[model samples]
Structure formats: structure tokens, C-alpha cells
Target: MAVHKVSLDEFEEIEYSIIAIHTPLEDYRLAYTLNLILELNLSRSAKDILIDIKEGKSFFSKYTFYDCKKDITWHLIQNKNEVTQRNNKKKATLFFDQNLEIPAQTYLLPELKKADFFLKIEACHNNFNVTKTVAKMNTIATINMVYSVKTETIKSKNNLIF
Candidate 1:
């Protein structure tokens, strides 16, 4: 419930009931800030972390998560690009487009909320199965990450696709 502005130096010793990180910098600053938070030994006591990166201009801390054993929730509102498979394409290619950064933002929230240790990983592939697998390994509790895919939108009728 408590929110505060934290600098790189202050992050190491911050003792707030709930830490809310709103960093506008990207990459180095973001990595340093997140690293500071993860390195802290207050995972068991912290709760409800809100990170705002909507205005972030750099991509420094794009793939890192805090390591804490608290009920943490992140409210990330940003726009980013994703790589998806193209229909009828034989080779792997990435198409860059602007889209809501929901997958990366909410991917680990549930696990972090129930975990005592922070689980930091790179990109959360746009697959619910991958998210669930990572969550299972990180949290102590049983939580499910599910999403529904429309059958009509799928180009391939392969049932073994995972």
C-alpha cells in the first residue's frame, strides 16, 4: 500500500512496507534497479509491488523480474513488439508490431505472489504452457495460467501442437 520513488543507490536499503517501482529509464538503470530489489533479503515481508514502465524509452530491463517471497502484484502498462509465426511461411521470421505488453507484465505475477524467492527470466514466450511451466517451478503453491484459443483462427489443424 505504501509507494515511494527509489533511486539506484536507495534501492539497496529501502525498507518500505510495499515497494512501487516507477522507473522511466530503460536497460542499465532498469536492470540496476531491479537487481537491487531482487538482491534484498526482504522477500518474506514485502507485498503488492507496482511497476510502471509505460513511459520507459529504453529496453534495458525488459526481461528481468524481482526475486522475492511475497505476494507481489505488478501493474505494467506499456507497448512493445512481439515475434509471431507467419501463415504459410516455411522459415522462422519475426514481425515487429506495437501491441500491449500484457504477456510479459502479468506472466509471473501469480507465481511471485505465492513464492518466497523471485524468479527472473527473459521473455515469456506468447504461450500459456510455457508460462505455466515456469510458474510451477517458481512458486510453492499450485496456480494455473490458462488462455483460450479460437479454433477458427488456427491455420493448422494439428492436434499435437504445443
Candidate 2:
């Protein structure tokens, strides 16, 4: 008898494209604008992408749209999640102890910290034209900038899968 082996690397492969978006508009407004211009029915997901932090859990806004015809799923995720942590330990004061609140920010992809948002497109087929899509996204006035992100170079690329 001969033994056969399979590699998990083959199973881990995922086909997806990431578009980095820089915009000052709020996540909801941005999603609405993209929906109108791109003809996408993006809606807020019931559960947001959450990450556990030293203080607590931080949530990032995420909107999703699925094109059944194209067999593609679109995810619009906010890169930065702002969280406030309070300092429980109080220093001795003259009267009362003051509780200080510290603000912190967590990024989905720490390597691309400057990007305000990321549009991830996952497809089983290879018919999606990323360049053309980026071009269309650039036409939106609300979007300050839009460009395709090379997934190969991302250190935290696995985070985008969810």
C-alpha cells in the first residue's frame, strides 16, 4: 500500500481583490454613495467585524453586497476602529479621584494604516475586472482616492477573508 498526502496550502488559497479607499465621509455615507454610483445594493451587516483589544472589543463598520449572478461577494470595511479605554487606577488627589479616558485606534490592516476603508471583492470565478472597478470608484466625488491593493504584499491578508 502507498500513502498519499495532501497539503493544506492548496486549501488555504483564496481569490480576492482589495481596493483601498481614502475618504472623509462617514462609513454609511460612503456606502450609500458607492451603492448609487456602482449600482451595488450594499447594506449594513447585522454584525460588525470585531477585534479584541487590551481594553475591550473594538468594532469596525462593515457593509456587504453579494452578486449572485456574478458569484461575487463585496465587503466594504472601515480600516480604523476608534476605542476609548478608561484608566481605573486613580492617583491620590486633593479631593476626588479622576477617571481618565484614553482614546485608541485599531486598524484592520496595520500595514495600510493610512487607508480609511477597504473594499474587498471575493469571487469564485475570475471574471471581475479590478482595474475597471477602481476607475469607476474614482469617479465618485466623495471618495478622495481609490486604488487597487496588491493582496500579495499584505502582511495581514488573512484578516480580509472574514
Candidate 3:
């Protein structure tokens, strides 16, 4: 599977899509990842895409929805990028809280601004690299920063989940 940008040609092929919204406020940052994933899961093809990417494939931005599957079993883990505001601008980061049930390739990437991205790899349940823990927040197990697209066009190849 791969992440590609959706073009005008494949509008009909898109089964489902998630658009992320990030707001940098004074006290804490807000991300609409949960809303997006929830919407995506509601689509007809979301399940298929999620299952495929669990193998850890590679996807690009800007593509079509004809590239997905229909056997997604796992849910999009909690948003990892949700962070509190800090005085240092450089310290701010959007992290995806990866879980043991989810695969590696089927994980979340950075905020998408334009274009699309895809992954095709199965991450291990015990992956313990680049983890982050917040006070009352779920611990982030892995970090897979993908691409960002400007247009609403999103193309997913596969996904990671139970």
C-alpha cells in the first residue's frame, strides 16, 4: 500500500477520508484526529485499507481511492500529536500515540497540509522506540511522520490495526 494525493480523476474511487485540523492555542493545542478517523472508519473501504497497511508498505500523497481494501479490524489509536502549549515554539510537536494492537505501516503521520501519503508495513506490538508519555495521557510508542496535503483530496492505500 502507499499514500498518494487524490486527483480530480479518482473522486469516485475514494471510499473514505480523514482531514486533520490542528490549532495552536495559548494553553494547549487541539487536534481533530479522532473526529477524522472516526469519520474514515464510517466509510465502506476504511476497513480494507487499514488491514493492508498493517504489512508496512509504502504510499505517496495524491492518489485515488481505488487503492484500498475493506477489512480494517483495528481502530485508530488516540491522537498522539495532541500536546500542550509551550513557551518554546520549536518544542511543539504533533505525536501519534501508537498502540500494540496497531501495525507499523498502518499508523498515523504528521499533519497533512497538501498531497497524500501511504504506508505498507506491520509494526510489532512490542516496539519500544521513540516513545513519549504525558501526565494523564496515553504513551506514544512509535513515530511515523508521513506527508501533508493542501487540498481535501486524500488517498489511502492500506492501514494498521488489530
Candidate 1: deviation at residue 12, Å?
35
| Model 3 ranges with Cα > 4 A deviation | 1-14, 25-107, 110-157, 160-162
Ranking by lDDT: 2, 1, 3
lDDT of each: 0.29, 0.90, 0.27
Model 1 error, position 155 (Å): 23
Runs in model 2 deviating more than 4 A are 1-6, 9-12
Q: What's every prediction's RMSD, in angstroms?
A: 20.4, 2.6, 19.0
Model 3 is weakest, by summed lDDT over 10 consecutive residues, at 128-137
Clashing pairs in 2: none
Q: How close is candidate 2 to the true structure, as a TM-score?
A: 0.90
lDDT by residue for model 2 (1-162), tens: 999899887686768999999999999999999998888999999989977768778888899999998889999999998889888888768988788888988888999999999999998989789999999999998888999999889998666766
RMSD over all Cα atoms, model 1: 20.4
- Summarize candidate 3's per-residue lDDT along 1-162 as a digit string, tens digits: 999898898664322223232222211111123223222231123222222232444332221222135332222222222222223223334774332333232224433332122212222333412122111112112222332223244233232222
